[model samples]
Target: MTIDGISSTQGEDGVQEFDVLIIGAGPAGLAAGIYARRAGLSCLILEKGVPGGQVLTSPMIENYPGFPEVPGMKLMDHMAEHARRYVDIREGEEIVRVKGGERFEVSSGAGKYFSRALILTTGSTHRKLGVKGEDGMTGRGVSYCATCDGFFYKTREAIVVGGGNTALTDALYLHSIGCKVSIVHRRDSLRADKHLQESVAERKIPVLFDTVVEEIVGADEVTAVKLRNMKTGVVETKPVNGVFVAVGEVPSNQLA
Candidate 1:
């Protein structure tokens, strides 16, 4: 038997003919495509933005198998390209609505691509600081992962936003790596574990209590952070090479 094309049927009678419509071009989505195509099923990939999803923004990934070290952006591109060799791959499209019945109704920006089954692989988005230029300068200097962007600021000063264990740990890591670290917390009290907090304190990482980053100052890259004393209402500028938003990050599973 031969594989049929996805656009062959109109689905006007509301009957899906294709085997699968994978939403998202992430690792999970592309892996599904490989399996579906190998199983001789018609598969189509629907992606809202550039293919590879949020993984593209990741700086580096060393935990994955085979390759000892690989950039997240490069890995995503390779996955998308490899999946295309087995199935029809499309990009830069979003599924606004999905209706399921005997078949499925997928309404996208480009058009609807119907399939008998669906694989939802839409991933998560990073929880931003909501500060101006923070979203725009992500990956440029503003990062969430100390493992990824830490090496870039070797022997340089960096600022971490948060008072919890993660933020303190990040500060310690940077401090150990010869980088001066500053912890800016929104509240005066730290909520980190006792041991971790003590470790951070022992390191002598400057703790700016009752403080929050009002603004991240930089021209091309991270140059400094505008910190605000929540109690005194005083604003101070601290020189730094990079700013890590350890406040938090949320998965981009809103679509899912």
Candidate 2:
């Protein structure tokens, strides 16, 4: 797959052009590849991480119709294979920046990939709790998707951090699945919608207001969280099994 005397080299400045360069290899990018190939255009998919993107982080998804329920990783694997049948799928190629024009040029870790059309499907990253062990053991124990890691913490206690809709939603879902959900927020007031607040209050979810997580305590897995009260300036620690960070999500639109 050498192009224009570039010798398929890495860190080269030469541009290798294609009819289409998809910036992600997720479901969206895979779908685009199917259509682009059917349209008889050369397509290339550049993905930074694993080919599945964030979808690989999900557990069992039941909402997607046609199948009763399917494993997220399985679905993504099938998609990647199907898309590869039509388009050239390149994984682990970090696209640093995109220069848009008549022929968009994508600068990657390898080299430049020029395309007549560019599909920006670079998704988002999960928000962090900034706590001690939280960042240290991201993939090991602390998780964003409950469905993915809930089974690992079955019958154990978990803490959800946030005062917004996402936090409340996570609490409700965890509570429904029989995990003791503790809602920890920094502010005394909740920024969630009124209806969502009502749901949280109605569910009798234990909420620690005006308090924030000072640090996540754990060795191999998250075992507890150190808490700090903003108003009283008191610090305390609560033993828990896991920490579900629901602060927010940051979209990966830097390449947009």
Candidate 3:
């Protein structure tokens, strides 16, 4: 039997064992670590990217319990710091394989980790629009989550790129949050359900049908979206402070 990417047979560093091995350093993973440590259990957390996951990229958070508004990274930093007092954190280690049993074995590019119990807090990744500047402008002006960034654009213009339920929901939510909200769908009509469609209309959220995002514009933050009107073959730029891509998410479950 092979683990996700590691062979069943042992290799380089053998296996580094712990009472519990938690994969991912997001909020869930960190919280789990805290609990484990509080219970006097030895726990270790492995993270492949930023310790906060997507929260690290979030510019502002409005509804996180205590604070009315806090920087996403700052909140995560506080979590990481608190969790660190109890558990060990390993960042930049990409876990590729996992073998679960009484003794679970996990392998990352860095090394092998073993534990009596394994917790997967592996999060999901937002699907991108693949337009030019989208990658470079991430967290600047291009965002994939409306809920996380909508509050930052109060009374400001923002665009949603998608046609599904999520896209429609984001558009309506942005409008409700005081944004000049609009949606740009590649298809002639939205793929969202009828109820969502009615809500968009009722909310007066503009829909740009048969449109594709050609580029995400901004230098430090999202400034606008360059859109191609498929029907008219016209390209235009819409000024905005935010661009939310509601294209769904891919889970970090390759090892599951």
Candidate 4:
């Protein structure tokens, strides 16, 4: 089981082999385990959690080219410390079961591996607005991460459901951290881009547009948000202590 320090090669029925398993540790499975260990092979990765998947909930990142800004968990912790110097990551595991042709096996609660190539990268998953109290108010104030909960809603008050580009970049990162943001949008223009709708109208924020949240009120945290509007069918409620959501993304692929 010693990954990273190497020694976990077994394969004469002992399983746990690998000339490249990958799965997902994000950043495309840590750049396909550093190009499958610089093309020499061995590789591994795995990772069910903890390895910067959704760019670790991205707070700042000026389009990764040469780190013009950098933050998404410090650029995935420098790409998982440069793919752990050469593969074999293993964080938490979670493969479940795979089994393909000439090699592949996989499984995972804690064992069975083998792999003559199987790279999934498994990314996306953050698109829920199925309304109604949103799964018991998600982490309390309900959030799909505005930089991982936007500093606990800085000055407080938040909304940002969706209008694209990750809900206007999480309403300009919850109005640049002081929170008090808004933006509901069930339509009525704004699919973000045009410099993020001109930086959310030069930072005036507010927005609501055609609205539509319809429930996520709160009892142990979020405190308000019922909205409706969609061309004046009206219905209000909007107090807000945080909600964020960002509406889009759903392809973790269920281990395809």
- Per residue, candidate 2 scores C-alpha lDDT tens digits across 180-253 of 88899999888988877898899899999999888888888777789999999899989998888888889989
Candidate lDDT scores, in order, read 0.77, 0.80, 0.82, 0.84
Give the per-residue lDDT of model 1 (tens digit) for 1-256.
1234434354666444577888888888899989988887777888887778656755555568986778778998889889888876667888888888887878877676677898888876545687766866777788887766888888888888888766776787777778777888899799887877898878788888999888888878878888889999999988888888777656655544
User: Per-residue alpha-carbon lDDT of model 3 for 1-256, expressed as tens digits?
Assistant: 2322222233336656677789999999999988887776667899998689777765566669997889788999999999887777888999998887768888888888778888999999878777788887777767777777788888998888899977887787788778988898999988998988999998888899999989887778877778998999899988888888988788978888
lDDT of 1 at 34: 93
By lDDT, the better pick of 1 and 3 is 3
Residue 242, candidate 2: C-alpha displacement in angstroms = 2.7
RMSD of each: 6.0, 5.6, 8.0, 13.1
Candidate 4: residue 149 Cα off by (Å): 20
Model 4 has an lDDT value of 0.84
Q: Which RMSD does model 3 reach against the true structure?
A: 8.0
Clashing pairs in 3: 4-97, 140-221, 140-222, 141-221, 141-222
Q: Number of clashes in every candidate structure?
A: 6, 0, 5, 0
Report the lDDT of model 1 for residue 1.
16
Each candidate's TM vs. the true structure? 0.61, 0.68, 0.60, 0.38
